[model samples]
Each structure stands twice: as structure tokens, then as C-alpha cells.
Target: MKISIITVCYNSATTIEKTILSVASQTYVNIEYIIVDGNSKDNTLEILKKHENKISKWISEPDKGLYDAMNKGVAMATGDLIGILNSDDTFHSNTVIEDIVNFHKKNDIEASVGNIVQHRENGKIVRLYSSKYWTPEKLTIGFMPPHPSIFFKAALFNKFGNYDLGFKIGADYELITRFFLRNKIVWEYSGITTTAMLVGGLSSSGTSSYKLITKEIQKALAMNGIAFSSFKIKMRFFWKIIGFLKK
Candidate 1:
């Protein structure tokens, strides 16, 4: 299977090399690496050019933001499956892609998910995010599956549609919500830690950003026809606090 992995970044000169090398080093040979740059001002472009041969296709231009660049890459991809790897994240191991492909082909599922661990720049793992046997019924309560650790059958985008550009922070949540709730998309967890994410993202910034994200997630729930008015998303926030202690 030709799996397309996309990395979207703005100014990732310091860490883009690790992301590039991780994807390039995947044991799965039939892989396509695409990088969508947001017209970086730093030496990120230089780094991308240095490893241009490993990349199947790439584009550098100003985009609306992260989700916009992700959508662009999805449109440009010509693979059977698609997955997005953040510029700040890397694979958990060399065989992660190979494992995902084997699981998908064996189980015959449309989508697959894996675990992720959040870490500091010094390589300290802080939190672990895992969806242990998630189902569509559970998603109505506002629980989200691991986005970066998910690989989707590319054809599903044509069936359900792409991420909603209206959402600034919760587009990934919204897209998965639409897929599992309104559509009959089959998905399974691969029981592996596929991604190691660096901490300090938009959601982890501070209280103001967290509140904005909660509001956007609420909007997404509504847009996806999930009647979660009574569901307290604040509980999800508390769940993160619990993860720091438990995981």
C-alpha cells in the first residue's frame, strides 16, 4: 500500500530534520512523504531542500494555518492511505508505518488509530494519550481519538469530505466526529504507540486558549449533529489533568 504521510509546519528549522528523518527511515518502502510549508522565514525551507530526494512531493507557500496546509496536502496526495505527522512530532519507531499497514490490510478496516506520548524538548515523556477500544457511541460525549496517530483510507475523504475550515482549533476533532457519527466509517486501534509529540501546543498554552478550544469543540459537536448539550466538555479538561497524574 502507498501510504502518504504529510508534515505541515511554519518555522520548523530546529526540529524539521528529526521529523523528516523519522518518516524517511520508515521500514515501509511504499511510502510518500509530503511537506506543506507555511512560507517559513527561517531556514526550514533550506532543511527541506536538503532532504528533497526522500520527499515525493512538497510545496512551500503561505497558508491560512495548520488545517489549511493539511487540507492542501490531502488534496495533493495520490496514495491509498493518508496520515498527518506534525512537524514537531516523530514516529515512535522505525516499524510504526509497517505495523499500521499490516494491521489495516489484515483487519480490512477503513481507519486505524494508535497511542501517543507527549514529551518535552529534553525528551521527557509527560503524558500518554490512548483510545482503548473507542466506539462511535462514546464519541457523542466529546471524547476524541488520537489524530496524529490515525491513518485513513484516502477514499473516505471523498465519501465524507475534508476538514471544516471554519474551525481554527478543532478541525481534526470535527472531521473525525463527522466520520464516525454521521457516516459508517470502520476504525480500529492498532495497540501501539505510534507518535511522540512535543508538548506546548495551542491547547496547552494557557487558560484563554483552553476556553477557546472548548468553545470550538462545542461548535463542532453541534455541526456534526451530536446532541451533546448536556455533556460537560469541562470534564474532558479535568481528564487531561488526570492523565498527567495517571499516565
Candidate 2:
């Protein structure tokens, strides 16, 4: 099946080249790479221009935020399967997309989820986020499948709807909660790490940002008819500290 990968970026000149190269180097030939930039005032657009041949489609304009750019990219996607890779992230290997394709073909499912390794500039592994043992209810504890490792069937958007721009940093969490908990979509999981997300992205930027995301996650859980309290939201810090210690 044809797969479309979307990269939403803003002023990511320092790292977006690696992200584009990762998608362009995918072993899977039927891949459509699309990028939505938020009118960056940096060399990001220049680098995109340099690799324009590999990009199926791209646009540069002001956006509300990250998820807004993602929604725009999703609207432009025309492939059977859709995945989002952030500008600060790269596929763990060239076979990442190939694995994603085979996972769906082998199982009669519309979506596939994998694992992620968060790393630093020296390539030191930080935390390994797995897609294993993920239940919709586990979301109550603030555990989520790695966003970069998820590949969804294009039609899931039509059925379950797109990311809620209403969420600032928790759209992915909210979307997963809605998909698995509220809508009950069929999906498969793999143990392989599909993406290497660079540190200092949206959610991990700072303590304040992390707290905002936790609050949003709590709100998202309640919006999806799951009972969650602010205490459960605070529990995220405990889990996050544990993850950091394990690294």
C-alpha cells in the first residue's frame, strides 16, 4: 500500500535536513513525503528547496501551531496510509517504513504502532518508548504510544476525525485516546523502534511545558469519557522521572 509521511516544521533549519533525508532514503518506494512549514525565517526553506525533488508536496505559511501544521499536511495527504515524522526526528533505520508497510499487510488492520528511542546529539540513547502493552485504559496513567512510531490508515481521519487544534501539546495523546478508547479502532503493535526522536521537542522542552501537557492529557481523558483527576495528571511526573532514571 502507498504510504504518505508528513513532517511539520517551523524554523527547524538545524535539523530538518536529517528528517527529510530519512524519509527520502526509505526502502519503501511507494512513499509520499509532504512537509508543512510555518513560514520559518531561517534556512529551513532553503534546505527544503535543495531536496524539493524528493518531497511529493510542501507548503510554507503561518500556522496556529504544530498540530495545525499537521492537520494541514493531513489534508494534503493522498496515500492509503499516513504517518507523521517531526522535523526533529528521524527514522531509526532505512527499513522503518518497510516494516510499517509489512506490519499492516500481514495483519488485517488499518493502523500500526511501533517503538521509539529518544536520543541526544552524541547519539546517546535516553529513553526507549515502547508500543507494547498499550491499552486505552493505560492512557489514564499517562502512557502513550510514541507519536512518531504510529502509522494510520488515511480513512481514520474521516471516521475518527483529525487532531484537535484545541489541544496545544496533547493532541497526539488526545487522538490516541479517542482512537483506541472512544472509537475502538483495530491496530497492531511491533516491538521494533521505528524512530529516533531528538531531545527537546514540543512536550519535553521544559517543566512548565510538561505540566501543560499533563493537564491537557487529563482534560483529554475526561473529554473522551474516561474518568481522570489532576492527581492522575501529577502522576505523570513520577513516571517520567522513572523513565529518566532508567536511561
User: lDDT tens string, model 1, 67-150?
Assistant: 899999999999999999999899999999999989988997999888999999999998788877566666665677778888
Q: What lDDT, from 0 to 1, does candidate 1 have?
A: 0.86
Candidate 1, position 109, lDDT: 91
Candidate 2 local lDDT, residue 131: 71
Can you give the TM-score per candidate against the true fold? 0.94, 0.94
Question: Cα lDDT for residue 220, model 2?
Answer: 91
lDDT of 2 by residue, 137-208 (tens): 778888888888889999999888899989989999999999988888898886668899888877879879
Pairs in clash, predicted candidate 1: none
lDDT at position 67, candidate 1: 89
lDDT (Cα atoms) of all candidates against the true structure: 0.86, 0.89
Q: Candidate 1: lDDT of 30?
A: 96
Error of 1 at 179 (Å): 0.6
